[model samples]
Target chain A: MTEFIPPATRWHTLPSPFAMKRGGELRDARMAYETWGTLNAARDNAVLIVTGLSPDAHAASNEGNPEPGWWDAMVGPGKPIDTDRWFVICVNSLGSCKGSTGPASVNPATGTRYGLAFPELSVEDGANAAFEVVKSLGVDTLACLVGNSMGGMVALAYLLLHPDSARAHINISGSARALPFSIAIRSLQREAIRLDPNWNHGDYDDDTQYPEAGMRMARKLGVITYRSALEWDGRFGRVRLDSDRREDEEPFGLEFEVESYLEGHARRFVRHFDPNCYLYLSRSMDWFDLAEYGDGDVEAGLRRIRVDRALAIGVKTDILFPLQQQEEVADGLRAAGADTEFLPLPSPQGHDAFLVDIARFGPAVRNFLSSL
Target chain B: MTEFIPPATRWHTLPSPFAMKRGGELRDARMAYETWGTLNAARDNAVLIVTGLSPDAHAASNEGNPEPGWWDAMVGPGKPIDTDRWFVICVNSLGSCKGSTGPASVNPATGTRYGLAFPELSVEDGANAAFEVVKSLGVDTLACLVGNSMGGMVALAYLLLHPDSARAHINISGSARALPFSIAIRSLQREAIRLDPNWNHGDYDDDTQYPEAGMRMARKLGVITYRSALEWDGRFGRVRLDSDRREDEEPFGLEFEVESYLEGHARRFVRHFDPNCYLYLSRSMDWFDLAEYGDGDVEAGLRRIRVDRALAIGVKTDILFPLQQQEEVADGLRAAGADTEFLPLPSPQGHDAFLVDIARFGPAVRNFLSSL
Candidate 1:
């Protein structure tokens, strides 16, 4: 159990004895965040960005860290986010290992890693933590709140739980609730990790007994769903790996170029993300259902959100968070009387289009924020 | 490594020192098949049914086996194929655990299970073996060749390698070659099995060291892709399992009904199928490329097949073998001057629609065979 903190990360100590949504309390917890540009004197220029599952608070290169962040192409000074005009803040979700208080973080009282002892996580808890970060910064109301993937669920929760928290919202490929198909995929991922001998019920050490194979499998599955088959056909097709790149001795090893690509991609990710933290955060997403707030109606729950203006963007090819989900969020917000725009872009990259396909997403995001 | 043979399965010995496509030979090897009807006097009424990876040769109930088989609904008397009118023969794929000479079968010389020692299998190899059985049965291919899923690829190979083997073909939810998306998925499945500690590089015993966890994960992945998200949403939705059904002690245990369904489904499959056989059969599909026969052009390869008529059927919601792949198969066959009917069925069962969505699949298959 370990936390991978980026160089540009900053911390905000949460209120003492902060109660979790799922019935547990953290005595001395903290949130990890990073900022870009200057806050206006009126403090109305603050734009908070809640991230997907694995992204760190370091969304882009800052003064402290020159290395490019996950969304560097979209979050730079003059990028789609346009940090030069609006003060931008990105926070690592609560249960993530990227410099945030998570299973990888140590319990202050016991001075040991929380691991499986961490409270059952919920998307609401992450929303509340992000809310605390906003309040601590002395921002009464955010000018605009942006969320991508899992963050979309958290942002929805934040708006529902804390009325008038933000004047506007932009949800990118996020859903109002966890659908059975998505839940099944995430459940399989968690099962893969748990089945690993090295996982050892989340008691394994980071250095000696890391669940590398399980993590690799989970990451490969994620990669497969993240992109569309259309893109795969256009890119790798049925191309085979070169003889030199082939593992001849290993019978079931990489043969297709697509297999090799997944292997390389999964290997790069397995060690960087902590297994326990990944499990906690992933389960949190699976448990998220805005319908709970609406007496079991997802649209009704979204209607409860009080954002003045909103934009929900999704890719046509996305399987994990399909286009219909974003439409649901847009429809719900619109039904609540918020001026909303639902844009389903034709990006072959699928669920990961928001991160990789900047040509289409850049203008859509920039236009939304410019309007805000 | 023990093979699970069904009661009705009969054997046909391959020629001695049977050579594999990818440079290896099997001595005293045999294929397992079951017949539903007697061969007519002219021997032109034979309809050979090839299968997907896991199914046995017993595709329907008969005098020898009272048990209903995998495709019982569509293969029995007065059904889709109408066993009474057509001498229906279903052969267990060569590399499957279902009574076929696979990795689970014993090596004649070594006197032990072949496991990894089994020659690298190919869709073409299975096709050739099926051809041998057809020849041994004293049939001069006159009716139709029916293939579903992996069998579709094998059938295509069978047609390509053995010219004029069958007069007509009905390919259900199959591709001319392996696509990258399907390759990625099968790669992850094989990786899951390989990662299991008990798998021990395909040397594990049936009882104690069986790769239950690995096979469970693999089968779950298979099940997820076999059906559509639309079907899952309609069937399970967000229904959570009862507390009694969930393992509360296991943090990452089953939560949703979809998860529970998958767990049970996978458990039922893991023990019945051998892991090494699965690896071989799955890889065989990934290795199949119709383009290899025609200077890297799939359409050109399909043109070489001399079927008099062909039908390519696909479900719209199938992600593993998407509707487009079947369209490709149909288009290529049409170019080859065959009277082809490319029926893209609107079934929500995904890749496995042919197996479960009989209401839609039954008629399409019946019409195709009747026309033949």
Candidate 2:
């Protein structure tokens, strides 16, 4: 409905007539980012952190924003990234609504929300935007590039497009291309949003006309896939909600705890995220294919990227960006002559494990950074 | 939507004021069924079939209906559960709209569609209705009972509530109770239907007011889960739809072949099945747990079922009613002193494997019936 910018977020302006990957251009577009710790005099100690969809640049609390961030546990001082030792820069993706120039941003020419008029966004576009931000920071090279989920795709695009930008890479639960299953899931989610009468071809206002129901359904479907069924079975089982929690008048209302959990999780998310921005980012993922860089060969595309070392981490239980994709990334990096390690953790949390299961992910990341 | 009855379907009126499982009663309600082969003088060469959520009574083509049925591959003369030897009967579940008295059927008192006025249905009620049909056919004891997906749950209820009504049981891709993951999927499907403005609290007419969009979404969701990701990966891969197949005008429209597949599948299903009936039956599934019969022990409740022999078959890739649930059924049947077999097939099709992979399922059913 509207942009949601974190207080800690800072901005970096891009060159005028910022070109988009697929076509069209945005004028006076800016990238949103937040940094933790100081940049070393050499500038080589800076690590760029790219984010998954739905996260702002606030990876951890800072002086400007004391609130905890989505990845606070994995990026703070004495943490996996260890901001005390390395300055970490996290940027909101280009097509996102988190203070980044996106569909929610006012059009420079029309002075209205870009909405459907926004250019078809691509992961490569986000990667290029982040590269601009990194260039503006006067960082010729970085210690490591970190990316999780959709961010992993962006990072890959970054490395492929800009050579030797980072010494090493850490990819968490990402894929080389969009698989059929993931495409279907994302397609259905977009359909849910568009099918909503309130969505109104991306013209709905933030108030009564917002597509709350569509957004709720889309988020619920996402939450269902983000975690493993094993976790749901163990945590909620067949537990029914209390009578007070139940909607008694409606026959097919909230009958189970899992349903209620999804309802609450979705309700909190719908208003905070712009529907148009979500559609763009999600469609971008479906369109991402490393093969485009390799003339219809994904492996050949991976071979084009050069890095000193790479580590691909994934959870065994993740059904969306599964463990095999992690192995693919590791193998591809190895083919590119980069010393690579693929770590498949046995976390039951699925695709979101890297964000929450810090105990398992922390050490691997720390050891890799220490080696760097 | 109006009830869709095949010409071959025959009806058996339940006793007036027939009681329901959770409460309430149906007046002059009827069960729809189709049968083949002749009953022997002994009246023991009979096999009864209960079905999944969508299918009607026409499980296989017969003299009265030459049209192929849903399980046409597995249930004809000289086939699995061969009608040449054992008289075969398939009944549409009580709450279904396929020639069965359900929400789509007329309420005798008001002479209008029952809609939400229909009482809450359960697996046990379906079981009882099928049992009534079997008794009315003068079968003292069924030679065997075959159930697939939701039917498996109904068959188990039949055996538990009416001991010795069936001598043997075949439970295919079914669970003793509703798992949290399954419940969440069904809950979302119901929500999609109810959230549609055209659904009109189940009062919408079948003409212009039909909740087509809601039903399409629900069916698409169902189709996504019915098969495995492994199958999707192998079948569709990341193939894009042809330019002609793509809905180019809509930004978030169909792009991938998988999305097109889902669209066609959902479009074919939405109008055929009644929205209210889908809601009632889906919620019934979420409410199905054998633990109710054992004071909160699903295993103990499953143990209450008694039969001469039992076969529980499931596919390795079935995420909905997973392989573990089939094992649970076998374990419980064995605990109840029935000679039980658990067969987990390596079908790529997942939960719907039983309906399509007849080459594998056929021999198993045939051998099990040969033993009976």
Candidate 3:
């Protein structure tokens, strides 16, 4: 086993100008983020890893666990991201429960949680916040900016907005625009949260229940699309989780392993996630559209990207972010004369494949990083 | 347009035995059905068209309108089913509100709708009910049995239970086994109904609201899987139904065409379908397993089928009942030494493609019936 050392980190609040997607005057905003690796003398060895819907700036490794961050296995000293050689930065996205300025964050005016009063955040706003976070770190340009899922959309948005901020980009399991099915699924999830009596119109600070039931239901729905049917069948199937039978027991019960898996997912999500933040982030993801900035021409918007290299990775079984979608991103980058590589990861894990099957995804990412 | 005439139709009640899947058994069950066309002197012109979830015995062209039934375009006088020569019958399925013994039907013992107390039904029970309906028609054997979706499962179950009953079977957009994702989806839908405050433990009378919100939510969830992402994007890519927008309106609101489609479906379904019956029928579809009755050997179960011919139709864009699933059905029939034909219909309507694009499906089905 390799000996690991937890990195000493410092948090900073960067000023972020809130940009609206539907068209309006930009608003003043700020973001909270952290840096793990050291910036080089030339400030060119920077790698920015943007976060997903919920996670914060602690992407690679954190202080308490000593086991690295959520993507620690893929981003560490001599790891795929190679923290020893390059400086890595992660940001807690906008409209998240993390230290980022979100629904849970205190409003400057009211000194209370922004809650429902928080302005709707778009993916471009997240990208803008990330850009501010990088600027606060005194980095003029980035060697590579990596993001996954909604984070990937943020990275793409970063490229579209800044144009000359990053040399390379890695978009993993994300789409150029939110598909109709995705919008529909997210809408239902938002409805689930909205319908919860305890949600209190997003002002449930006094309610201890905090819309847990609705959040749990939303999480259950999320899990269904997060993983593929084949994976669920192979792992869970119709096998019963428990065989204990009692008198007067309900005859028709959940006798399937998949049900248990989904239940566990719901339980954990309800425990950790804030319903308001989930709603805001999901809406941010649904409203993500790079082409909207360029008058609906996706290719034209991509052509504005001045990145030297781009990497697009998609899971074959990912119905949500599908291989075809990643190909579109790669094609767009290629059309812009950027050196683009499209990697299709074969796995039955679907949208979760990027997070779960590291053995297959890690090596490909490492190879790509090394090449960069 | 061809001039059409209404046919004199006769209705009958057939005894349907109910065997609960979870535990308890229901005896002396009965099913209601209707028949059209004529039986030959040798009693060999029988053709069964199993109706889908919630539909009653009305499957073909009725008297008032000249147009055929739900499948009337393919089941009329000179249509695919050839009413002139074959005896056609459509049964209102068990656990449905279409003149059949369902949750809404009065229990002879209690003199009230079975409600939550209704015994859990399986596809086997549905097939048994259809068997009684067919037998009551005075036909010892059937020339062919045709079905779609849930009805298709019933047809397959009939083949599994009574191997020598039908000479041919046509299963449209059906699966050999319920997919795990489908099971998960159904489970969530059931949970939605059970969670609804107005559900009143499934005892809401016909005059009551009947958990409309829960039913609508369930339909919304169900509709997502019924169609493909491609179709959704093509039809409704974030186009708002309401043109006027206020400052406080939701950003990127249900502007997509697909949203309207889903809304229409949910409204229509909630108006026509019973919440408890939907739960029961969905459960029946989920619990359907041909191999379970044949000692866990699916191939062995298929080998036991004594059908002379089989035809399987799958929709290209159907994510719920994918083409691969239909192929599995066809493969099983072929393994049973039954002459089989598999046709994959290309349409954007997804699982509902068979119902929506009747013109194409009608011709294909008509040709197949002519050949038979």
User: Predicted candidate 2: interface RMSD?
Assistant: 0.7
Which pairs of residues collide in model 2?
Answer: none
The model with the greater TM-score, 2 or 3, is: 2
lDDT of 1 by residue, B1-372 (tens): 677999988999999888999999888989999998889999999999999999999999999999999998999889998988999899999988888798999898899999899999999999999999999998977489999999999999999999989999999999999899999999999999998989999999888999998899999999999998889888998998899998888778888899999988997887889999999999999999999998999999999999999999999999999999999999999999999999998898899989899999989988888776
Docking class of 2: high
Worst 10 residues of 3 chain B by lDDT: B1-10
Q: Write the per-residue lDDT of candidate 2 for residues B1-372, one digit (tens) a residue.
A: 778999998999998899998999999999999999989999999999999999999998999999999999888889987889989999999999999899999999999989999999999999998999999999979999999999999998999999889889999999899988888888888888988899999999987899988888899989988998889989998888899988899778888999999999998898799999999899888888999998999989988888989999999989899899999999999998999999999999999999888889999999999987
Q: Which regions of candidate 2 are displaced past 4 Å?
A: none
lDDT of 3 by residue, A67-170 (tens): 45678678778878888888888777766766666777667777676777777678887787788888878888998999898888889999888868999889
Consecutive 10-residue window with the lowest summed lDDT within model 2 chain A: A1-10
Model 2 residue B320 CA deviation (Å) reads: 1.0
**For each of the candidates, what fraction of the native contacts does it recover?**
0.90, 0.72, 0.55
Rank by TM-score (best first): 1, 2, 3
Looking at model 2, residue B107 earns an lDDT score of: 96
The two-chain DockQ for each candidate, comma-separated, is 0.89, 0.82, 0.51
Per-model TM-score of chain B: 0.99, 0.99, 0.89
Task: Give chain A TM for each model in order.
Answer: 0.99, 0.99, 0.91
Docking category of candidate 1: high
Tell me the TM-score of candidate 2's A chain.
Answer: 0.99
List model 1 lDDT by residue over A270-312, tens digit each. 8899999999999999999989999999989999999899999
